[model samples]
Target: MTVALMWEARAVEGRGADLLAWVRQQPLADEPLRRDVLRAPQDRVLVITWWDAPYDADLPELPEPDAELVTRAVHRWRFEALPEH
Candidate 1:
């Protein structure tokens, strides 16, 4: 299994119930959902996803503003993950 570290940051101009509705509609649109998203207060969100197959997670193929957010989100950092010992 493989896991991808995803991240996103959005401006404060648009924050509403519509945002939630839009996000929900998107998960199963073009591809099956395989992600976990975490929010940082009101301006930033991070996502981590797992794949059973090899994937190149470029976001240009997704929705406009969201794809742009993913493209610039930056996903090349490394960190230690503690395993159960």
Candidate 2:
């Protein structure tokens, strides 16, 4: 099975670049099959990591940034990839 973990956060005001840099500097306990970092309007940053594990498996995820750097708590989600038709 394959699992994809998503972590999203919104930076405070004009600190989007700083927040993105911080996320890039973070290291996971284990490397994933693949990873991606994305950004959007409103200073939102999103990271997706794909791993070869069960849906309920315990996987390493990105940690939350400092409170002062973000507008609110981070959002996270996990999904099990389905077969490609």
Candidate 3:
């Protein structure tokens, strides 16, 4: 099975670019099949990582950055891809 992990956070005031750079520098415990980094209008950043793992397997996730970097707590979600129709 494959799992997709999504992590998102909105930077404080004008710290969007700084936050993005911080996240890019952070390393993951395991290498992902693919990864994406997105930026939103409100100084928000979204990171998506695809991994090969069992549906219920415990996977390493990106740790939240320092509290001062963001406007609020980070949000995360995980989903298992369904078989093709």
**Clashes within 3 Å, all models in order:** 0, 0, 0
Measured on C-alpha atoms, candidate 1 has an lDDT of 0.43
lDDT of 3 by residue, 1-85 (tens): 8899999999998999999999899899889999999999999999999989986777878898899999889999999989999
Error of 3 at 17 (Å): 0.1
Tens-place lDDT digits, model 1, residues 1-85: 3434343445344452334444445553334236665565554545454444335443312243454333244334322234479
Candidate 3 accuracy as TM-score: 0.94
Candidate number of the best lDDT? 2
TM-score of each prediction: 0.45, 0.98, 0.94
For model 2, where is the 10-residue window of minimal lDDT? 55-64
At residue 23, candidate 1 shows an lDDT of 43
Show pairs that collide, candidate 2: none
- Candidate order by TM-score, highest to lowest? 2, 3, 1
**In order, what lDDT does every prediction score?**
0.43, 0.97, 0.92
